[model samples]
Each structure stands twice: as structure tokens, then as C-alpha cells.
Target: MITAIRRMFSSTIGKFLALAFVVLVGVAFALSDVTGNSTFGGIGGANVAKVGSEEIGLGELRDRVRLAYNQARQDQPTLTMAAFVESGGLDRVLDQLIEGMAFEQLATDMGLGVSKRLIDGRIADIPAFAGVSGSFDQTRFQSFLRENGLTEAQLRRDLRQQLLLEQLAGPIASMPRLATGMAQPYAALLLEQRRGQAAFIPASPFAPATDPGDAALQTHLSQNRGKFTIPERRVIQYALFDAASAPVPAVTDAEIARVYKDNASQFAASETRRFAQVIAPDQAAANALAAKVRGGTALAAAAQAAGLAPSMSGELTLSSYAATTSDAAAKTAFAAKRGDVIGPFQTGLGWVVARVEDITARPARSLADATPEIRAELAKNKANEAIVDYYNTIQDAVNSGASIEEIAADRKLALATTPPLLASGRAPGQPGYSLSPELAPLVSQAFQGAAEGEGQLATLVENEKFAIYAVKNIIAAAPPPFAQIRPDLLADWRLAQGQKIARDKARAIAKAVEGGQSLGAAVAAAGPNIGSVQTIGGRRGELGQDGQPVPPEVALLFSMAQNSVKTLEIPGNRGWLVIALADVQRPDPKSIEPARVAAIAQPLAPAFGNELVEQLAAEAKRRIGVTINKKLVDQLRQELTGNAPVAE
Candidate 1:
């Protein structure tokens, strides 16, 4: 229980909570309310709530809410306090705190508590409090507490409460017997086999009774305007400044010679060898194989006789071979001449007999042979420097309020403009607007900065490219005219009508089957194009002939009684299916393997424990009687968010 509690507080949630508390402290200091009496000065700064005789202070409540806000911002980066409130983030945080306090109160009533020494151990275990040598350092701990506006006493008190709650809930939640009964029924269902036949009635075979005219199209458009509405788009004018386009100084011969002299070792190659080996399970087997190879039997033939295939060790350096095989094997192979057969040597993987096929010696290259690569590297570096200098000049122009066009003209940079394109890179019904992958970042930046009405410099590729862009025009989202989408509307209307026809046919077939008619006979009576019924059998998770898990419709078949039939709409408007349950073959409970049952129960155990813990906490809350100060909570909410209280 202590380990679990420590892990929870040391994980991401703990880090986020600490950061949020520090942020709250900073905000309080900046607002001149560090003492808690200046901003929320009324009601003598009392506790926000009480669980039995225990009080949850206003400062702690505010910090928890802020922590929730910070955590939520990881998923929704633009989340505002108003949005957070609307999403019920504050209420959730309060409920969590209330539940925790309820557990702590229950623990106190039962005389369960954590010792000061345990609390000290838990604090010392936190890595953030550790020094360079990895043991808890008093100086670092004190410095952290001071910087985060937390006192040692307050931290210890919080840790003790957390530990006590864990002590109260841990045993009740860790009961192993709770999952056994719940897992049995699910395991039986998972292991049950079923056989059934389904026939599909294709929606494509049924056509609409009549075409959708203008009036019908207009009505459809009016009812589903959001579907036809286009997203807001922006037209951007931008310029890319990159190293590839910058002027580079030419590389001199003397400079290439100096670079080659300074980095001579880089141009030297290592000796390597190619070899093949036959591994045996024992020294006797390896010795027999080595004797056969020495007696002029081909290595492959000898390996084949030994019931093992010859394996090749592709060209490898001495160090590389030593890392993979044993140092003894590598040393023997390297010392042997080319085409030499050696090694009945012992290795980490039993024993090996090796034959060297070829060997290559290390060699050094002359300066002339290395000049081309050095000159290219020098040119790249010089071009990068030039680009950086040019960007600084561009930054100066931007600071002076020069327009993109003016900067491009003065600097001779390439400038281009894009047509109004949606953030999804689509114009209308057409596929995405084609743009180079390198320009994606610039496009994203343009959309983000469109509202500001000024050119913004954005990094395109880190250290290689940069772009400056401004919105030339803004196109607001609106629904297309009925005339413009008339064809698409007609096609959609036809598809919907065809689907209804298919559904009606499927429902009739299902009714007939439920009335004791054979599924194959009903499907044949429906039409010749409706494919013949086929039987598929499998356990719940087994894949069918199509290599997909037994379809949901088939799974539903097992849930029904024998001879019962149902109609299901297949996904993607392909068709509707009328399925009849044929047989459900359940395995005998005694015959079910213990390993399979355990596999099914392992993941469910933790979930069942969590549910029990939640129920216990709720019961504890009721027993202790939680009292929340609504007026004070509302005032604190307002002060923290700068928004008026939302009426309950």
C-alpha cells in the first residue's frame, strides 16, 4: 500500500500538482494575496469544506483546481477558465478532494495512521528532493520548499493524510476473491463457440423510386446545412529563406588539405572477415563436425549430415564479431589465414566449427580521394552561416514594420501566394490542395496568425529554413448554395432511399425466419443476387476466413436463443444482414483451462478493486457527513477565474 501510494505521488500527476501549486503561489504573490486574507478576505478565511471534524482549507482547494486546469491544458492547449468551468473540471476536482478527505476521516475514526518516520521515508524517496549523489539532501529539499512556497510541516501533514487514506482503502480494494465470481461468467461467454449463417441484401440493388428534384434538394440542404458548410480559410503570401538558396563561398584546395590532415583517422578502414559456422549442442558434436571438415568434407555437407544448416556470418570487424560471438571464436578466426578452416572452440552458445571464406585488411585513403567530401561539408557550413546572417537582416526589416513584399524586393528572396485554402488543405469536394511537405509548417503558422493581421516569422525546418507569412485575405465559413451541390444531394438522396428499401426487405426476411422459415429459403425467395447463406463458426476472438475478428453481427447471434433471428445493418451501407442463430456450443466449465481463466481475470481484477474503492469512499462520505461552504467556494472560484459565479 505504501509503495503504491508513493508511486502515484511520484508519477506524472504528482509533478503536475507540484507545478500547479507553484504557479498558484506565484499568482498569489503577484496579486498581493499571499496571506489569503487580501483577495478572499471575508468569513475570516475559513475552510472550504469539512468532513466530520477535518477541514479542507481554501488554499488547498484553489491549488487543486489550478492543478486540474493545468492537467487539462495538456489535452486542450487553449482551454480557458470559462471553458474549464463549463466542462465541469472544477466540480470534478472538488469531488476527488472530497472523496480523499472522506477516506482520511474514516481512517482517523478507525485509529489507523502513518508514523512520522514513514512520512519522512516517503519524502526522502522522492527523486526531486535528491542531490547529485542521489540521496535525499536537506539543502535541496529546503530550497524546493522555499521556491514552491511550501512548508515542510505542511508537506508532511499532506503526506500523512494521503498515507492514511491508502491504509483505509488498500485492503478492501485488494481482495482477490472479488474478481473470481465476476470473471467466471465472462470467461464462459468468451470461450463459447457459435455456428450461424447470414445473407446480405445489398443496398445497391435497390434504386430510388424517383430522382430528388430541386425542391427536395433545397429542403435537404436546409435541414443539414452543417454538412455542406465549408470551413474558414486563409490566403497567405510567404517567402522562404534557406541555406540552399544562400550564396556559399568556394572551398580552397589548401582548406581541403588541412581538413583531411586534421581528420585522417576518419578516412581509415577497419579489417573485416566473412565466415560461415556450424553450431553444435556439445563439444563431442562440434569435434566430430570439425574432423569431417578437416577430412575434406564440404562444410555445408557436414552441417547437413549433423541435422543443422550452415549459417553465414556476414563481413564483420573483430570487435563486432567479439560482441556477437565469443572473444575466443573471434580471436581464432582473425588469426587464421584466408580460406583456413578452424575453431571447434566453445562459445556462449555451446560450441562452433568455423571456416573463413575471405579477409579484408584496413587501408588509408590519400588526400585527393577525400577532397570531394570535405569541400561539400565546407560549402554547406558556409551557406548555413550566410543564411543566418541574412535572417538577422530580415528580422531587422520586420522590426521596422517593412511589409513582406518590401523585404522580398530588397533582399531578392522568393515570394509566392496561395489561394484561399481551408486548414484541412481542401478547397471544396476536391482532394487536398497540393503543397510540398516542407511548406506545411508555414501554412500552419499562417492560419494561426491570420487574426493578428501582421506578418510572422516561423521556423520551417529546424536550423535549415525559415518563412515569413501574412494573411492576404480571409474567407469565412458558410454553406454552399443549393445549386452548387445539387448533384451530390441527389446522389445522397438516392443512397438513403435505397438503404430504406434494403432495410424493409431485410426486416421481412427476419420476420419470416422468426416465424420458423429457413434462412436460406427466405434469402433465395428475396432475390437471386442476394448471395447464398454461408455458415461461419468460431470462438469470440477467433478470426474468420476474411482474417477479421468474428463480425459484431455474428457475436450478437450467440447472444440470442436457438432459431431466433434478427436484422442488422452492415457498416458502410454495403447491405443489411438477416441472421438466424443456429447453435451455441458452450464448453463444459470443468474442461476450461485454468490458464485461460486466469488470463481473462488478470486485467479485470484492478478494475473491480477500483470500483469497490469508489463505493467505499461514497459510503464513508455519507457516514461522516460532508459539509461544503458554497458561498466561500463560489467566491474562491470567482477570484481564481475572474468570472462571475454560474448559478446552480
Candidate 2:
């Protein structure tokens, strides 16, 4: 549940914008193509390529790498188990670093800027900033920024730049006619898959054969370049410090029980239900139909006359149900019970009437069910949060005029004995957790400072809990043995083969169909069980037999509409499907007529990301200059030990 909520706001657009934020400044910014120059050989010299005249300071490079690492880890959840492994995530961080430098340069040259108000607005809208009750919590928001090594001013500056970059790219990527023309191709594709009958054979019945020819593999590679390459992974040896580092306190059951009673509202209780429904073509039509049923019309008989099927009811819970409906009529229908007939209420499309067969509210979630969370939290409070103390001790020592060594001695925390680790966390000069959120600032300050083996005081931060850190080491990423990736190469090869077959067949069928071949004739000619052509509309989910509605593949089938034929190659674990289209339907704004079936979907995806992208862009554009510490980069490269280049 915790992971889900976080992922909920991370839409594709938000990710794209995040990528843009990194690259916006570098894309058109200064170029460090020191083809034959010597701007880089100063003390400990730059281990990284300079971005124009600015040093791609090691400190900035690492920080950027960390950010990219975090984001990519979240994006590719399937690549790891819970957390990113060194071998898989570091390259992603490096790539992002390179892109950031590139875009920063670009933004700089373009003279882009973002305003404070925009950044503020964006911050205000983030769910992370929301209080427990879903309202804006300035304290929480500020706390998060502080913990993440950011100040409102800095974020605003960065966001401003990000905004400008997005604006610059906006016009170019807008939804032009060419993009919308996707509908034509989409429509014909669906028309090709008309509702038909065929048997579905399970892969369990077949023993697939192996390919013997190198030509087969070569052919596969020739057609599927996308599948054969590595994702350019990096192996950062990061040291983490947070909840995992802070020992979980032993909060008593009594305390947890007391807290639960004190906050009973925190415990959720609801009933799950199964509902069956019958909808009319439109609300008015549904209402009229309902009147007949209410006027002593038999449900089955009336359904027959109205060209509708008798609606059935089933089980659903509060979590699975929403009052707002795809069709206004259906939403209005929700108000009625199975046995009770109700008048149709007006909906966005038209009027609706419904008879709910039954409604049952059963027991839902309880405190006992969620006690582990409560206990962990109470434990933190009871322990006075050692994580917080870890930071406070450092801050107090810094304020009391103590050097990093003294502070370390007082807490029995070893003064960092080695140099800072490489920014990528792939490898490190010192042994300990890397700029792990707990020590992010300390690491930043350490690498940016002039002295080596010296500690630096940093602002307070919060990874899992409020904290601060000291750093004395840096490790850089290193290239891995090609032998380690042999298995990956083999898998890539097989995927390429499947894609090649699908692509080749799909194109061939599309061409033949376009060359005046009738669909029936094509079906007869093809050896495989022919898939039927379906004329699907923008809206889907019209209940099939037994209330089974259209699947997403059905929607993808109708996403385009045109006379010219096209094909969709669906790859599956068992086999691939090549679907060819024959007809299409264009969007008719004035003709959003009845029968434009729409499926009930989750809320038109949470718009949080839409708002996030705009805000992040605005922030990135605000801060125009940063002096990256190149000396740190060299130290980092030497520490980490790989020749992998950082983003320029």
C-alpha cells in the first residue's frame, strides 16, 4: 500500500519531465569539447569531462547520479527486489548525470527562466506535501525538502529552469494532427478484428523447438535491435543509512493499543458488496426502460423488447466501487437497490433508471490488521528517534565549534577515516553508507570542500528520520566483465527472434490486405487460427455474455480508424499475435452519439503528474549557475575505479 501510493503519482509524463529537468540545462549549455585544451589538470585534476567552462564538479556529478539512480529504481521495479543492486542501477545514474549536464548547457544557452509562484504552486500540489488528512502541510513539505538537501529558494530556482525547458519543448511535442491521425490506423485495426469465434489453445500442449541456424539468430538481430543491448547498468557500492541503520525501537503493545483507541478514526471499517446492473443506451432511454419494468414489465421480457440483456448483480467492495460512473445513467443507477426500482437521474450523457437487486455492507479493515505500522511509528517516538539524534549531535558539534573529528569522538562515531565515495555509489574510497539520504548533505559538503580526509558540517536532513552525516570517502563506478552479461545476451537474443517473426508477419499481412485482399480470403489463406475483426468505438466495456466487458486489447484495437490496413504485433510468453486492420472511425466531436460505449475506468488518472511536470520545469529554470567541484570528480573516479564517463 505504501509503495502503491507513491507510485500512483509517478505517471509517464512526470517521468519524462523529470528526465527533461536533468537534461534541460545541458542540452544547449556550454560544451567542454576541449579537443586540444588544458583547462582540466588542476589539483587532483578533473576525473570528469568539463561542461563548457564549468567544472563537472565531482560533488554535483554524484548528487545528480544519486537522484537519477533513485528515479530509475522506482521506474524499473521489476529489475530488483525492493531496492536497487549495485550492478543494475549505477549506469542509469551515470546516464542521467550526462544528460543533466547536456540539458543544463542547453537551458543556459536558451536563457530559460521559471518564476517562484509556479514552483510554489507545484510544491503545494504534491501529495507528499499533503497532511495525513489530505490537505497541504507546509511543515511536512518543508521538512521533506530539507531532508532531501534542498531549500525553498534552491528548489524554486531549479524548478524555474525546469519550467522553461518544458515550455521550450512543449510546442514541439504538442498533440498535432499527425499524432491524432493515430485514430485512423487504430480504427482499421479494430475493424479487422471483428467479433468472431475461434478456439484458444494453451501453450501447455506444445513443446517449442530450438533454432539451429545462425541465420535465424542473425535475422532476429537484424529486425530487433532494441532487444539485444544492455541497459548500460552501473554497479555502485552504496552504503545506506536510515530506518535500516536506526534500530527499530521496542514500543509496547499497551502504547500501540492506547494510540489506536485515541485515534479510532484511523481504523477503517467498510462493507464489500457484489452488484449486478443493466444499462440502457442513454439515460433517457434507460429511464423509459425502467418505467416499463416498474409498471409491471418483466425484466427478461422487457430486456428482449429493448434490445438489451437481463442485467445481473454481483459482489464489490468500497475499494472497488466509485459513485461517479462512466455513464451518468450508470452512476444514477447506483442509487437503486436490486429489488427496488428507482427513477433515472440525469447524467452527463442522459437520464438513467436502475433497479438494484441487493446491497450488502460487510466488515472491512481493522486496527489489529494495521498494528505493525502503528507499533513501528510509536517505537520511533519512544526511542526519541536515534536517527534524529544522529543528525542533532552533528549539528550541535558543528555549532559548538567542534571539528568533525571531535564530533565523531564524542558520539563514538568514527571520524571518516577515508576519502569520500564516488558520487555514483558504485565504488567508494571510504567504507560506509554513501550519501544515503541520512548523509547526503555531509557527502555533498565533503566532496565540495578544499581539504581531503577532513569532515564538513551540513544542514539537518531526514531520510527515514531527521538526521545529518559526515563523509570522508568517495568511490566511482567501474566497468564490469563482459562475461557477467553473457546470460543477459542470450535472453536478449530469444526476444529478438520473437519480435522479428511478429514484425515480419504483421507487415506482410498489412501489405497484402491493402493490396485488395478481402479479410475472409486472407483468413482462409493464413495457417493460424484467424482472429476476428471487431468494430470497437472510443468507449469500451459494453458487457459481453455473463457481464464480461471488453479488455484493453479491445480498446487498443480501435485506437485508430482508416481504410488503409495496418497490423498490431502482440508479443506474449506463449506466442505473438499479428493483428491486421481493415477499417476505421474518425472522431466526430458533434457526433458523440449514443452507443459510443465507454468502460468504467479508474479516475481519469490522477492529474498530480500533469501538475508535477509543469512545476518541476519551472523550478529547474530558476537557478542559472552552479560551480561543480571537478577536483572531487577526479577523486571520485579514482576511488570508484571505473572508466565510465560521467554526463558532460
Query: TM-scores, in order shown?
Result: 0.47, 0.36
- Which candidate number would show the highest TM-score if scored against the true structure? 1
**How many clashes in each structure?**
0, 106
Off by over 4 Å in 2: 1-69, 78-156, 159-391, 395-492, 528-556, 571-576, 580-648
On the 0 to 100 scale, the lDDT of residue 37 in model 2 is 25
lDDT of each: 0.69, 0.44
Worst 10 residues of 2 by lDDT: 596-605
TM-score of 2: 0.36
Q: Lowest-scoring 10 consecutive residues by lDDT in candidate 1?
A: 25-34
lDDT per residue as tens, model 2, 1-648: 013212322443434345523331221111122121223223332335444444444444444444433344333422221133244333443433443444456666777666677877866775555543345766556544544454565455455645754665554333323222323333333223333111122221232245435555455444443333322222211122344444555777788888888887557564444443455677666766877888998766776787877655456444344443434344444455556665555544444444666677544447787688898777767454566545444554554556555655555553323232433332232455444455544433333322233333343333353222444333322223335544544455555455555455445555666678765555456546334443443332232537676654454455544454445444442333333444443444323322221111112223333444445444443343333344554444443323243333
Clashing pairs in 1: none
**What would you estimate as the lDDT of candidate 2?**
0.44
